[model samples]
Target chain A: MKYWGTLLLLPSLLFAQPEFFGYFESEASTMQLGSTNYNFGFNKFRLDVEARPNDHVQIGANINIQQYWGKTSWDVYDFIPVDHPTGQGLIFTIPDTILLDNFYMKLSFKLADLTVGRQQVSPGVGYAWNPVDIFNSKSLMDPSYEQPGVNALRVDIPLGDRSTVSSIILPKDVLDESTHQFTLKSGIGSFDLTATAAYESEKDWQTPLLGRYDVSERNLIGGSVIGEMLGWGVWVEGAYNTLKIDIPPWSSFLPPDSEETYAEYVVGIDHTFDNSLYMLVEYLHNELGVKKQENLSLNHYIFALEGEVNSLMQDYTFFYAMHPTFDYVTLSAIVFSNLNDTSGVFSPIIDWNVYEDTNLSFQGSLNWGDSDTEFGLQDWGLIMNITSTF
Target chain B: MKLKLLLLSPFLLLIAHAQGPTADQIVDRVTNIMSPENSHSKGSQTIITSSGKERVFEFESWAAEKGKSTLTRYTKPAAIRGQAFLMLNNADDIWSYFPRTKRIRKLASHAKKQKMQGSDFTYEDMGGGDVFQKKFKSRILTEETRDGAPTWKIEMSGIPEEDPPYPKIIMWVRQSDYYPIALDYYNEKDFNTKSLVLSDIQLIEEYPTAMEMVMTDNKERSSTTMRTLEITYAWEPPKGFFSERNLKK
Candidate 1:
């Protein structure tokens, strides 16, 4: 398309000599589940460019190209639709094409800063989970991956030395009233605080047997706090939502009321030792999640699939550790456990800095539990990546 | 008058040579010259591996209260940019800020013995000030010529109860300005484990300063070269700039 041609040539033409940097990564992974196994090989290349033509304006863009080839026992097409090929809101992935991760222009004024275009706008302080991050919901499985961006307009105004107010506007094809977010952040004494509010529109909950049901509009309110205590770093974030949904005429078994309210919260702490050993622990409670298997049904499963809830388990815990064993080698481990089911996934990773800009990493994940419990459906997985940045 | 003045010139030169400073006085002067009351510097460090591979890091440093409080923030190598370290005057605690997580971690005491930023320099090496006089006993070993400059060879041994990183250090202090040109560090086993050389002497703020330095790890066969790009002195940083609250910024 014409846009693709322009995206390819714009970086080179904008500045005679621009600041260019990015990384090339190749990954090979194998997953084992029950009697079936899946193998995947991925090659990814990312290129970033930034140019500041003057003191008042700057432009930046990140282009990503990835090619994946493998065989899987499960159908990947079933999870993603033709209209949403990337399976994420921030990226656009074709069968065998490149994706634009970020492209934005920022203007600096005397009183405020304005940024427009597609860019990531993460505004929460939680390490493992951010309930207030409504713009981009990150995947806990691979937390290191760069988050995708959304097309929007943002404005940031400074209130004082240590406070700021930011607003973002996301526009869809048709003009609507429920696509704005406002956030206020400030530093008080040793703690940093943030409060945010946003509006969300209803969408259909899809199911395999039943067609679709309309969900009601929702309003989200959240806040977060981060500070240091004694020698440890602590953070807490929580979000509350008010929702209204109408049940279908035939579904008389559902609850009579069409209104609901729920909340989610996470508390975390982290520390580092003299031997270059770092540790982090976090606990999360999702009110929308089902507490027990008996409570899980077709209706709740559909809600989970529609991104209304995080997991089937209500209580979850996360632990992470990083130890520098050698001069250029680091060993890391991460675990996510569903406290209710006592099932979890454990991942061990090793990173070696072979050269100044070259790195090699080996990662493995092992899941434990029965078939019906959380993380019990899959067996084990292994991934190795070689990346070089410039 | 001309004959009398010509005769006293040699005597005046001899008097100046004889009045050279003592070892303790020379150490005190070097400490003061190196760590000013309030200073700022921008520098780059290059770590060279045994196989000749190199990695460079750039940083900005600020010190106040004659190096009693200090802060250093990395500015280059995108992966490490925005990372910072703060050292306060009240305690030996060193706080580190990780930009990725937006967290500040306090390093343990034993971390002083570990290598700094994967370089040959240890954390104790960058913790500069009047620590030498407080921890080591100094005495002049001999007078010799180093790099064609007459120098006072000073040998300093750690106090018995101090438990320092190194047992002894041999320094070559230039007699002309009392600046240390080179140092040799010996471990408890009496092995020369590390060595440092200071070069490119220049005058900054009317004080003699070293613009280039190299630290070699004899056991590992590796070295790190540091060069000062810019430096200033006598400008006090803002109050509370070195506190934990500013680490997040």
Candidate 2:
């Protein structure tokens, strides 16, 4: 009864008018994966709130409400499963699906900042690939889209005008199970430099039989540098990770139990011409990736699905170009290629600034190659989005 | 005698200056008047397309050290609500923070010439410094009067080594105050491409502020207008307020 009363008071928050804003968006999408064709779409409402009740403390939240079309009816077991339970589920029961993307509090001091609760921590310089980040996964289709939040405690200390040292700790059931990272950033003679060290948890599930196959952890040290050279913007990001693996008995070609070190790196450059034409190119090399198409196995696919790695191929390239075709219309094209497999996905996008705070966008992706290839497993996809804000 | 003096006013205004202020001195005064000691400004920019459609963006901007450093944050148009831009050394150093991507991107120094947010203003214009004086040479062309007010017609030629955004700039300076009331911009081919008109002037805190500004594309028939909603020359930023950590926040 008390919780219900508090829920009723949520609407009264509008009385204070503490910088409340957000947007409403509707999207339709269709994709063909392998031989299966799927069509889906949803309407989403995101409400962002920022409040300062005092001088030194600030609080904020990003709440989302979404409903999917052609899927109005859902079974109760989806969200409120009648199986094992947790303390959060026991204390608060939800009758509907509500998502809280960001709920955090920050305290500002003269020299440093302390932040706690669910927040986003993004660290990298690469456009399509970030080798040092483990807090969230990026969508290749929408590389610049928003990131998901993770629960953590972060502290930032400023060294000078353009230098900072940040420490973030993500706790789990026990201290031994937590993930922690320390990052240092500074500017050196027109260049932005970053260095980071982290301890992250990793796991993998084997195919044919859905079972917890290999569970391990990794230690990563990485850095990125961005600067201008010969009138072009250039950057390089790379990470070296050490991990222990367990080889399954059924996997004959797999190596025996051993601890190994691998590196993931990206190099990119961009330039915008005087005529307003923008172009960028990037290359990624993953040492753990499969070198030959014949060596590609189900375990590699599972590794990608489990977020253990971003790509299954050893080498890849990304190219993008954008130009304004009209006063209100902009056109862009992107190509992501797997160099090892000779397969790729080409996407063309268009954005129209319809009116104040309103936008219309259309994006399409076409895959090229055989089914045995990486991107070829997905045939084609298209999405249309209409968004308006207050 | 009073009637004769009043009738000769127009002719006197056309007379050339003898050992008076040069074009460089006039430009120096205008730059100083435009760049205050310290400032915090809140404003809006409205972009009108050739088809008569309009898009508005609201922003809060801060600058210090005679426009050597500047920070601008956009609050309206939800698409870019939490976007912030920081520039130092007249845009020789630039950084952009995107709330959606939770990332900070560094732009090349040469990117100052790119159009800013689909508006007529470039990053160079937003730099809010004496970049023009540092990149070009100015000379007085002729003396004139605008609306019965004494004015100076000045011509600016770009220095090739600086790689200036425009090849030429023509300014109409109001003599009463060191303010460029009107300006015309030329493109690479030295064609008169855009013209800027300034109006709605006011005096606040002993500083001259232009409340309204409009830049029009002569051939495209489109324009972008900026209006100052609130401004203060007394505001001072705390130490490290313009740092990257604050920008990310």
Error of 2 at A9 (Å): 15
Residue-wise lDDT of candidate 2 within B1-249, one digit each (tens)? 999999998777666454558899998998899899789999999999898888889999989888888898998888889799888887888899988777888988767767778888888877767866878899999989975668899999989898776889999999898788888999888888889888888998988788999988786788999899999999898888777877866
lDDT at residue A195 of model 2 (Cα atoms): 97
User: Which residue runs does candidate 2 get wrong by more than 4 Å?
Assistant: A1-17, A33-36, A69-97, A202-215, A245-260, B1-17
What TM-score, over all chains together, does every model reach? Answer: 0.72, 0.87
Candidate 1 docking category?
Answer: incorrect
Computed on C-alphas against the true complex, the DockQ of each candidate is: 0.12, 0.55
lDDT of 2 by residue, A1-390 (tens): 524522533443334356888889899988877565667788889888877756676677788887777434322222221222222221222233468877777888888899877787888989898898867666677777778787888999999998899999887667776788999999998899999998865444343322445646778899999989988999999999887767666554345564668999999999888777888899999987888988766556556655668677789999999987787899999999999989899999998878777889999999987766778767898899998876
When summed lDDT is taken over every stretch of 10 residues in candidate 1 chain A, the lowest stretch is: A76-85
Regions of candidate 1 where Cα sits further than 4 Å from its true position: A1-17, A72-97, A172-178, A202-216, A243-260, A298-308, B1-42, B49-53, B58-117, B120-198, B205-207, B215-223, B230-249
Model 1 lDDT, residue B50, Cα: 78
Best by DockQ: 2
Candidate 2 clashes between residue pairs 3 or more apart in a chain or in different chains: none
